[model samples]
Target: MMLSVFILMTVLSLMMKIDNSISANCYTCNPCPTPFSPSSYLVRNKTGCRYCAKIRPDGYPIVVRDCTDTCEFSTWSYMFSKYSYNCCTGNFCNKSQTNYPTHQMVILLLFTIYLFVNKTSTKI
Candidate 1:
């Protein structure tokens, strides 16, 4: 019984460590301009107009239409990292977004560990 408990603890600890590592390696969005425009001169062409271009969170270039001005231009673009691309035509990466399945899995793992520990400790 003790051996099983020890193995369980080691596995749980390893799982948690792996999760932390994955989270650390996860990509993060660099701060960029809002209503990003590739041709707008309002912000000195590039100044105050931080931009990012990279693979979308869903692994697709976001389709964006610019209506900030009278004209509307639509295009597909990926914006994940700042200064990665000269022009952005869609929403940039927002790291605040959470993956429900991953979150649930972590929670479930923690809960299972809790229950296991409790059950093993009780004499009943």
Candidate 2:
């Protein structure tokens, strides 16, 4: 019985480490400053990123795209130019400005789980 228990523990430990890899992927771009990044490069599984994002600052022709923790679309104006930002959740979601948040959708369900518990509980 002791040996059986040890084997079970080992199996569980291995399972825990198996699925930590991030399956989500996104297009990362930063064509500015030293070590310019290509817009076609694909990025996988950032430690704290749940969503992909794209932002274009005012007055600058460059747009930077990458992973983000949240999706909050907003616009900010600073002097001459207006910056527009858009966010979405899914794999390869932040691909382009006109792509509208995704081509290869991984789904919002991937990271979120909803439990629809009934408000009424039967009493025995």
Candidate 3:
């Protein structure tokens, strides 16, 4: 029972750590540069997330957060040259630019779980 409890706690802690580490904050605004304090949005899929801006160089911009390939931002950016686009992942990272994570931690977590299961099976 103690071993089971310990294992459960370890898994729970790892899950929490991964959840906190992978979450991203992005700046969200309908029209950029209008407000001094723009709202930030949360992204579920930290990978392939994007923060896009339209007409930023023109001084009036439309900024959006956590845009996927199916979003209008992707289409607009690909279809036009006037838009400034960025992608990134981190807490409030999109406040400046856009980026993405390689999900190394997720892969590592899966590997750890696999090893744990394999060890348990061997013992049984």
What TM-score fits each model?
0.28, 0.42, 0.33
Candidate 2, superposed: residue stretches over 4 Å from native: 1-23, 32-48, 73-82, 99-124
lDDT of 3 by residue, 1-59 (tens): 45765785687678656754453444545444443244323222234343322224334
| Candidate 1 TM-score, C-alpha based | 0.28
lDDT tens digits, residue span 34-97, model 2: 2333333433334345666666777777776667555555322332256677765556666655
- Candidate 1 weakest ten by summed lDDT: 64-73
Question: What are the per-residue Cα lDDT tens digits for candidate 1 across 8-116?
Answer: 6787678655643331212222222344443334322212222222222244344222112111112222333322222222232222232233443666677688778
Which candidate should be chosen as best, given lDDT against the real structure?
2
Q: Measure candidate 2: CA RMSD.
A: 11.2
By lDDT, the better pick of 1 and 3 is 3
The top-ranked prediction according to TM-score is: 2
Models sorted by TM-score, best on top? 2, 3, 1
lDDT, candidates in the order shown: 0.36, 0.49, 0.48
Output the TM-score of candidate 3.
0.33
Candidate closer to the true structure by lDDT (higher is better), 2 or 3: 2
